[model samples]
Target: MAGRSFLLRVANVNPANVLTHTDRALYRSIGIFILLYGGYAIVGAASFVDASSNYTHPWWQWLVGPPVAAAVIAYDRAVVGRVAVNYEHLESADPHRLLRRRTAGLYTGRMVLALLFAIVITEPLMLARYKGEIDAYLGTVHNRELARLEQSGAIAAFQRQIDGLRAQDAADDAAVADLHRLAESKRSAATSAYNQALEDSRAAGVSRRAGCPPGGFCDALVQQSRSLNAEATRLDQEASTVRQAQEPARQSRATQFAALNEQIEAQRTSNRTTVESAAGFGARTAAMWELVQRDFWGFGFFYLGVAALLVCLDCAAVWLKLVSHGNGYERAEARDARRRELSELRRHQQELRVTEAATDVADAGLDTVVREQRLLDAAVSQATTRLLAELEEQTRTALTPTR
Candidate 1:
């Protein structure tokens, strides 16, 4: 019984005035509708925030839900409360009541607002209901976004740079290797000629020692050995110089290759992050629509049915009030309103009468004051005329005595 009363109060009903079972039941139903919508609004708002945000906290929805639900409930209450039950027979007879009659535009505006709220709340609930299908669709979206990112201009440019650097590095390595091989081959030839010359010098010395000759062949052979030894030393020095000269170039190529590879990796990481962040509400909505388009008869119809149900729920309070216009409670309410208006009008008329009496008394007092002032002015004028006449008579007596 207490709970029922509370619900009725939520529906803006005066519990004392609710006498009929129909009024009790209807107001209770409206209240229940309001409570249900509040709960749905909370859940829907939380789901909306969770779906839309990149970083979701467990308690964040609690923070979001209550405020949004409160606002929605307040709006619902206002919408319901604005729908005045105009029992036309009673209203038409009373001029004051006629002035308070709601217009068609008011009803239309309330319904429009209710419909908008229904759409706002329904979408998130629908998204939550078909989460699995939407998730699957989102998975496809994620993969597609990733693929698109891979083929994007920036990533492609990075890959091309990396490939070019690798090719240039390989070419540089091959050129350096060929130079080293050629230098080694020339050094080997110089070393071999020196070795042969040394052997010939030893043989020529042996011939000289055996008394065949003095300084001709042996000296020539020794000098050839010396020249070949100098050539080998020079070739080794040239090879060392070539290696020293190529070291900086080799290091530079290595640095360039490494830098380009790092850049490509960074770009790839950015692309992956971009794809990962595409799982927001807008993306999910698009995915859901795609699903609807694919399975229109199944999902689309279901979607429409759910939306209609929500819209009906949201507008129920107003519609109930509108339909239950000539009910007993409304009649009582209208009667009470008319009584209060009449009492107020009577009090205003009484005040007007009191004000008129006070005004009449003040006007009479003002007239008396004017009459007294006129009498006083007449008395003062008669006294002044009498004094002047006596002065004139005294002046005539004095003149006649002088004559």
Candidate 2:
């Protein structure tokens, strides 16, 4: 009666103690589960957040969302009170240490998971950058092509200028030829008139010497010859001056045409060079574009693989957790089996040590027995030789008795 009354009193005093302990255990288990679930959720959420935005959103913002929620929950729930109660009996033991270890492991796993997600995400991003670079290169190539076309047109125009200059030079040459012909004709006329004048003078002198009286007709003829000679000389001088002046103009026009022709040729060469350079640039740009496309396609496949791997990892984790929850007995049995294997290995090692010692003893005894047998073989040989000699002597003695 007294034992029953004591038990009732103790149970009455702490009716809620058992429930409290159970609640604390349940909460801790829930906390561990929550921690793992939260980590996975955070990882997945962060991936979504990172992928949702283009290159603009901040990564830190995505990272902070989950932790912020957890922090708020912790603050509102007074996690400190619960922590104190749960750890009251583990003051020296530090039960939270296990939680801390788990939390650390969770953090490490999350980091790895996040890194994997980032790797998968960054592939697409790098492909996008590659595409942009190739596009920009192609744009530059196109611009150069356009500029080259314009340059080619300008070169054609320069060629036309050269052609016009050549035509003008041809006209100048023709004018020069006409002037030369006119000058030559004028000089011929002048020479003829001078000769005529000389002839007239000479004839007049002959007439005077022959005693022929000089007539007014001869004087008039002389005057006419002098006037004609002077006029011819003036015309010849004017033609010669015009020819000299035309020579410089024609040479200048030819020089201008030659210079224009050189410029046109240079322009043609430059245009050709530009065209070739642009072609090279275009080829390089096209190759780069093709490379970018290839890389993008590769990245596309890589991203798909990563996504599938992530899904597989997630499914495996979920299945593992489910098995942990649903098949606790099997897991426990497996752990027990592992422990039994360890024990069995230790027992085998001990048995092997004992067997090795026994084998060493047996080998030592065999060595000693072999040495004793070698000594006994020598003694047995001596005894057998003596016995054979005695038997021979006995046979001789017996033979003599019979005689």
Candidate 3:
């Protein structure tokens, strides 16, 4: 009694308790019959609810779950109360009439709830699915800007500027190498000329070759030696000038490369920061919209289908409640049905036993004693038939006497 009252308090005014499964043991026991009726729909709705609970979502996303569940219970109470009303009017205009204005509210509420449940269950996964869109959008912007800089020749020009400085430096090195080679060759030639001039002076000093005294040398040989010495001094001066000029150009090239490299690195770093800084929530939302447009025909349709199914199940839960009674009513229906079945079975069993008993009696020796009783019935029937014929003849004979 205590349990019943507790259930009643929680339940609507349904004496039948068809709307609330607070005591679901009744359904589980006689579930086969319910299954035969609308059990599939009942189970489908329940399984969907359970499955929704398992969807991957943050706790915050599921904030509405508890409230939605409360609403379902509340809706259950209202429906049960309606069922009670309908039950009360079983003989009146209200019996099983769910199309009435009062009853229609139940359906409407369920339809609305179905939409809510669908939203709650799928909303979290939906967000998770598209979370990458933000990063993708930002990354694209970064890459595109870099590509634009490349396309505008800014980066290439920077590279070329560095390469030109490097080339200038290399040219300076080649110029120094050529100067060294020239100096070596010039020194070798000057040494050969001096040696040859000294030999000519020796020959010039010979008395027979120069037509002069033994100690005297030719004057032209001395002049030629002086000129060759002057040429060697000029070559040395030229080599020193080239070396001095080469050092400055090389230093200038190194300075240019270092400064330009620093500028290029800073510019790249700044551009990267700008691209990242500009990507915000608005950009991500735009990306999300793009994803929706792209996938609406594919996976987006899948979400829609899921939502529709949830709605159907929501409505199905209510329909099952209104169309069928609770386990209490169903138990009675089952019991009564079982009783009829048992009665039929017992009747058939009784008839079979009676037939078997009759056969046994006929097979036994005592069965012959009833022959006189059987003959009595036949003899009575014959006598009645003869008396009827005799009466008809006597009537006809009396009519002839009057003639």
| Ranked candidates, highest lDDT first | 1, 3, 2
Number of clashes in every candidate structure? 0, 0, 1
Where is model 2 more than 4 Å wrong at Cα?
Answer: 1-137, 144-341, 388-403
Q: What is the lDDT of residue 226 in candidate 1?
A: 59
Candidate 3 per-residue lDDT over residues 1-403, each given as its tens digit: 6564444445443334343464343333222222222332333334334334442333453344445455565665565434222222222332233222245665776667656655544443343445666467658867998878755555668888988887876776677667666656656665665555466556643333533233345444444555655665676677678778777777777788788888888878877777666644345445555666778865467656655654554455355555555335544433444455567777999999999999897877465656767788899999999999999999998888542
Select the stronger candidate by TM-score from 2 and 3. 3
State residue 371's C-alpha deviation in candidate 1, in Å: 2.1
Expressed as tens digits, the lDDT of each residue in 1-403 for candidate 1 is 7766998778877777788998889888888988987887788777777776642636677678778777766766675554354434542565445324556775687688777766566787788889889888878878887788778768778777767867876776666566566656656665665555455555643343432133655555445555655665665566577667767876887787788778878977887787777867777778788888999997999998988898888778778877776676766676776666667777999999999999999999999999999999999999999999999999998888542
- Winner by TM-score: 1
Candidate 2 lDDT tens digits, 1-403: 4542332222122222223443334334434444454454455455444434433445574675487436423432232111112212222343232121112343345446545644544333333434555455656766777566646676567667767867876776566566566656655665665455455556644334322235643454456656656665665676567667767766776787778778767866776566445423235335454664668575445545655564443334223323233132222333444455567777999999999999999999999999999999988999999999999999998888542
Query: Which portions of model 3 show Cα errors greater than 4 Å?
Result: 1-16, 19-96, 101-153, 171-177, 188-256, 273-403
Candidate 1, residue 116: Cα displacement in angstroms equals: 3.0
Q: Estimate each model's TM-score.
A: 0.70, 0.28, 0.36
RMSD (Å) of each candidate, 1 decimal: 8.2, 20.5, 20.8
Clashing pairs for model 3 are: 18-326
